[model samples]
Target chain A: MAVYTHLGAEDLASLIATYDVGELVSAKGIAEGVSNSNWLIETTGADGAGARFILTMYERRIELDDLPFFLGLLDHLSAHGAPVPRTIHCRDGDAYQLIDGKAVALIEFLPGVSVDQPTPAQARAVGAALAEMHRAAHDFPMERANTLDIGESLRVLQHCGGNALATVDPALPEMIDHAARLSAAWPQGLPQAVCHTDLFPDNVLMRGSSVTGMIDFYFACTDAMAYDIAVTHAAWSFDKSGGRFDRAIGRALLAGYESVRPLDPVERQSLPVLAQGACLRFVASRAEDWLETPVDALVTRKDPMDYVRRLHFYAEAGDNPFHPAAD
Target chain B: MAVYTHLGAEDLASLIATYDVGELVSAKGIAEGVSNSNWLIETTGADGAGARFILTMYERRIELDDLPFFLGLLDHLSAHGAPVPRTIHCRDGDAYQLIDGKAVALIEFLPGVSVDQPTPAQARAVGAALAEMHRAAHDFPMERANTLDIGESLRVLQHCGGNALATVDPALPEMIDHAARLSAAWPQGLPQAVCHTDLFPDNVLMRGSSVTGMIDFYFACTDAMAYDIAVTHAAWSFDKSGGRFDRAIGRALLAGYESVRPLDPVERQSLPVLAQGACLRFVASRAEDWLETPVDALVTRKDPMDYVRRLHFYAEAGDNPFHPAAD
Candidate 1:
């Protein structure tokens, strides 16, 4: 949720020197990334004008061995000319450098802001961006399993215990029941592609409804392409608490995704269940974090009930939420 | 310490239009500032090239009424050709616009890094910059008393109680004793200037060894200029934990300030007491925060012992620390 590593100017200067980027001018810690430290690095370019970059230090919830896959995906996506920032390799041609036993990488800075209350057009653009990324990542050389899958969600919920979940939110215990139902009804073997499983609005960069970049590829993995759409829809269609559903934005997202690669009938059919599954993913994770904190701690932990609301919305709305409304 | 406010792109774009600086290009939440939300804002210039600015949303630990003094000091010091950034006036000629009950201001982004590990030359530059600010702020219209002075420190310590302090560290109550002594012998009315009382290394931005910006004037007030130097010394001259003191940095910093505005005899003699007072200020604040947290909580609060160590160092070294060391 915040930058865990405290990098100094001297440290940053030495790190930037390895990238063939000119002298380091400044590095500001960006208040972003869930389990990593990110800096908006500025350096003198070959033309003496300052160049901007994002230097990410993998701090937590990341394996050092998985660096090649994450960095390689960005490389593959960028090489395919998707709107993804390429991972800048060091002079030694390495994707990342191991500093103090943690892996860090330099990424090209793309211009744009991440819209929280995205317009319908912006939603469509993000949908298109995801579809394009799916196409670009179709032939990526490396592979990693989606570790936080249906089984894992159930395991986490069980680990949290029903009483603990109830303590956090009265409705949270029912998420376990929903997870079981989702597990039984989960779709099997549709179309597969590399999925940006966490394509919330924050992971997207936009300028005037155009997506300049799709970032934070740490959670990316080989998964059902339709599941990615469901995840993005579940993410962008609702308010943070999942109390309000924007059907227009939801339709725009699906239309934008379909605009690039038209969804198969099978993919469309699996969406309702996939969306429910997506909701449960957040439910399990947020519940674990919520239950870990004391009952009265002032620490601002995310409410798992947010996802519980989304799960119920999906259950009640079914396929009707995806239909486009007359503007 | 972190961005507490979540400003959406729409919120930022509308905010930027008020400043008349440029069209919003991008805004990143900078992981800086102790109790305010800061965004590293980028906007397109009239020349069509992009420019950078820091947009701050005053969240907590700041009074809305005191904004004029804070922003006005920047405008005053900037006009006086000090290396401080000027506040960008709104189209309506306001220094800061009230947004949803919180005051927001745009400031010219200065180029430099907030060095955690500062060089001797860098320390010297920061000292010179402080002296320049003191001279420039000699006739500023607004005046705010040093609220977080020795008196406040003692008050906060008394509020925290001896048991709470002892629980944090065995020697924390010793800080109370030292603080009392400093309060009893505290110098009265020698010299007055608008002092940046919290001139830590992070507050002073640097390019190589040169100081480009002296920022984060939230704690600026009319206080002893010598006390400002002592605050900067207690801040910049020691490691974060205050376990180790750098003699070269201390000597260089004092010499640099003396170069700009030569220290009076009384001021020079009072450095040790002022430095100890500075450490106690930090100790009081950190102790309060530390005592408020649960003993087993994983929250990474700053240790008050860090400043406690510095307080002890000042007590032992006396005036010896400020004198130039033999090469």
Candidate 2:
């Protein structure tokens, strides 16, 4: 709902006509995904057989140039025996196409429902999967991507005026001001790699306690590997109250990742700050988005303080403390 | 620039003509904003010679329907003596206009350089200003805004697929799963009020360690005031290495906020979890945005994890421990 794809059943039908894979039985929007338009496509062949695949209309909201790198990485991972969706070729023998001005592709559906919650064992499996993917992706052809230089996030905060500032209890502005200054002095120059920038639990698919597949490759790029690890730690370790970090969970994830592609000393050393950076980026962006969202789009409210506190924790810890729980 | 407003200069000219107040001496783009095209217009002649105003091309990236609320709020705050940009009427005596499919408006500008950082005393001033604004806006009429609903954020997390999940360490899926389950039993039904959805440090302007004004009203809407306090705390307080919490700063901020507007027991009770929820929202969104940004924009990188850890901290504490730093 964040984007309007200008796609409809008719457009889908017309597009599918050229792909002689099979007679289309039905296609409907799947109730998953926040960034792209995804439809579960069911098809019956002339031979009276059937198969299911996910028809995804790549979000134009994302930069189109990055598509090849993302898909290529997925292909590379899949070729290397990573658990990922296999790109189904289109009628033109291409794995991807531009349909209705969006990067459209068909991916063979992986079996298994998304687990709402996972046990520690399942968490360990996820660690293993990620470690394996990072290890396999080391030879990804594209170079690493850098942080966006444009201060778009800073600008967003600037857009909300006095009223927004008023809501914050008294001393916050100074603390923020201090952090902003200190942020200028934050460490730089870290080792880079093919980073899965948006890894979180929901992105992984499971069947009973085993991670069956990993999906969504859009944010994949070359960046600091430690950043990727920090992202994972942040996403995996926090509890529901968003209050405490679960040491066991953090250990499992890191252990899983390290088992495949061992972290260098520098990567390990910078993990905490990398985590802090992740927190700042989100807090800044969410605050801006919260300010920018239209008054009535059925858009949900976002709390800006959660990440603020999280950043504080990472600042205090100063390093990754948990060993891999999976091992 | 994310958006291009075709007629920025022309729109400013139109406003000048309508207001019949002054002659424009200079207009230049202010590069500090992310969502809208802004220009500083120096004016001379009628109402006040040697005066300045800001011409803004409303960003179309925002939900168009919400412009009125934002602009109207600005006007209201200005009327109540809050240091804000006063809207200048159009030739037809309207506060806003459409030019080249963009919302265009002009407002009286405050003249001062934006201080990048402010001292703790200034932070207190910011807190006091916020209190004044909240007090002024307590009865100002506006519809409901973002409520920081946890359900929607959880839904988005669920859609993040393996590509996104893999980027995170495996342990996160379990942690998220646990959080989702625990969230069902979390407290609800708290008092709500108008909140500034964003209040980061950069949004406030200071002159010689004195907070002169608060700017940006795009995210201002009706929500819990504590959420605003949490947002401020998140923005202001930080630990050393810029990842941990500074208790003194937190105290200063909270003291400033509570001085003007006393928080009832209920609001105080909700602060910790509200802070956690805020962290989750930022982490989830940053993860999603990381996935969506174009790989080539050089504008993309992993979000910081500080906020995630802070969430854990708050969860562990299970209460707000903020107190004013003793002068």
| Top candidate by DockQ | 1
Q: What is the C-alpha local distance difference test score of candidate 2?
A: 0.64
Q: Which regions in candidate 2 have their CA more than 4 angstroms from the true location?
A: A1-327, B1-3, B6-11, B112-117, B168-175, B178-189, B239-242, B300-304, B323-327
* DockQ per candidate: 0.65, 0.01
Q: How far is each candidate from the true structure, as Cα RMSD in Å?
A: 2.0, 29.5
Those runs of model 1 whose alpha carbons end farther than 4 Å from true positions after fitting are A296-298, A323-327, B296-298, B324-327
Task: Give a tens-digit lDDT track for model 1, residues A1-327.
Answer: 467888888888888889888888877899898789899999997578778999999988899888899999999999998999999989999999988888899999998999989889999999999999999999997889999989789989988989988888787888878788899999998999999999988889888899999999889999999999999999999988899999888999999998999998888888889999998999999889887777665457888889889989989888777655433
Most TM-score-accurate candidate: 1
How would you encode candidate 2's per-residue C-alpha lDDT over B200-273 as one tens digit per residue? 66567554445556777777878777877877777677652236776666776777777888778887877876
> How would you encode candidate 1's per-residue C-alpha lDDT over B1-327 as one tens digit per residue?
578878899989898888767788888999888789899999996467778999999998999988999999999999998999999998899999888999999998998888877778888888889899999999997889989999889989988888878888888877777778889999988799889899887887788888889899999999999999899999988888899999988888988898899998899889999999998999999999888877666457899999999988999988899766533
Q: Model 2, A1-327: lDDT tens per residue?
A: 222353443466566666665655544344346677776665564356766567788776566777677667777888888898778766677767886567888876665434434556766777788777777887878864644311333444445443573364242233345345445654567766677776777577665566767887777777767777787777777763346877777777777776677787777877776777666656666666666665553445466666666767777766645434222
